[model samples]
Target chain A: MKLYDRVRVINDGYEGYGIKKGDEGHILNAEIRYGTFCFYREDPETLADDASASVRIEDLELVEDGGATDEDILEELPRHNPEWGCKVIDGFIYNLKGERLNEYAYDYHHRRIK
Target chain B: MKNLEALYGKVTDYLKYGDGWVRRENISPKDIDVCNGEATDDSDTRTCALCVALNRTVFKNDNKPDYTHPYCKCEQIPTAPPEPTLDFPMRKITDYLFVKKRGLMYSMGYSEEDAKEVYQMIATNAKEQFKQGKYFLNALDNHGQKVNILLAFPGKREKEGHVYWIKTGWTVYPNGKLHQNTPFGGWAK
Candidate 1:
């Protein structure tokens, strides 16, 4: 499924065609102390130049739900991604990994944590 | 009178040589609204005279610090006495009080004299209201040594007439450090 369409589906709280093993996804994480989220793709080589790399999630989950079978290794995906880039969704951007993201451009760009 | 003398001595002792202390006096409800430099109304003049008398006693205390008694006529002004029985309504005013460090009073546009006059008027009113059993008084700190007094009148209908009172003052040590004292009083319903 297209990344945008897949994100739209999961965000709606419905389990559609699920993320497959070895299929690259993005991870999003939140920095609670700073009141900010981070985004980064799992593998840089898999990221398409034109495709978004990251998304932001409400929080990190230790295990992924909605796997087809119990044998499926529930990969804990970050709510944010960096390499695949970001897309604005629902006033927030969701990445291929189903994570939420934000643009890092800030007043003091140099001081931003990578 | 001996008690007054003894109280004066204690206050002066607290003042020390070049030291400063605050002098508080009880004021009547009628005197609360009077303005500065304006002739005090006849009814309240007696109250004002009491304040002046207290000021004189504070001045005569031998224990007071040198270089002009730390008792600047500044704090000699009368304040409303606390009411233990009557209930009065408290009203909040939009204007906030702000005091600057080093014994300076600051208001948006008012000169030093003007600010002092306004402050005196407000303090008087707050004290009177407290006596009438209306509101509460509070204080805010600024730049360490300076403090602003707030008169928070009661808001609840049942608490309508209680007033809170706060008076802020500062003493400067020889090392240039400032010590602050904010005495609080209340007129309970």
Candidate 2:
């Protein structure tokens, strides 16, 4: 399945791998490792920040086909609030526009990369 | 803790259907975290992955052990018949699928007749044949010819008793050539 295809958790696999049964979301990224496809759920905060729910390919069943227009994907992605600050190349600090080093630390930390 | 107990129960139940079912085994504390049920690999819940893998490979001598935790509540569950299986709302294969499966089987080098027999073999052993990946499986034809089959488990509808939705089929040879229209999904496959 390509990106933006909707997926639903079909079973309670192990610890649910972060997504519970009936949890539905668009697939942001998918990669096959160790003989299985690991899916990342959709959520975007800032550049380099990935917000996603991890699920096994086995536990997920394709829901909607991914024929999303570029506009659709861009809309689904978490947009950068102009006030949040610029994207940081370094891993630690983000949000320089505000007085704090990381006004959105919680959001950045919660980003599910890969 | 309840989930862990449930997981243990599920494993033992599947064990009952195993062939030449040997003695049941328990995972040790060292292999898995006794305190938190955390996998060393940083996965949130690999114990469940182990459970599925065990259900698939338990009959083999190489089946690995899995521990829910050191204080695993399931360690004391009785091992014997009166086996309790988790009730899943299963789905039955519709007759319409037979027509679709025919083409899937022939794509894997099965003669029309051979495809019919292989189709039944796959349907009957659905659980064993189903693997979580890019929707493909390895099976033998009537002549024991190794073949690959592509099956999809669409999330749109849950086929209660049904495992893989065998909508696509293919075949594989000993040399590892996948003879299906779809490409294998993995590193450089």
TM-score for each predicted model, relative to the true structure: 0.16, 0.23
The number of clashing residue pairs in model 2 is 10
Cα lDDT of model 1 by residue, B1-189, tens digit: 766765775665555523322233334332111221111323543444323223211221222222223323323322222222211101101111221111212212333434444444555554444334332222111111122234543222333354433332322111112222221211122
TM-score of chain A of each: 0.18, 0.40
Candidate 2's TM-score: 0.23
Position A7, candidate 1: lDDT? 21
Clashes of each: 38, 10
lDDT of 1 at A39: 23
Cα deviation of A21, candidate 1, in Å: 54
Interface RMSD of every predicted model, in angstroms: 32.4, 16.7
The residue ranges of model 2 lying beyond 4 angstroms of the native Cα positions read A1-114, B1-64, B76-105, B110-119, B126-189
Per-prediction DockQ comes to 0.01, 0.04
lDDT of the candidates, in the order given: 0.27, 0.32
Q: What is the RMSD of candidate 2?
A: 17.7
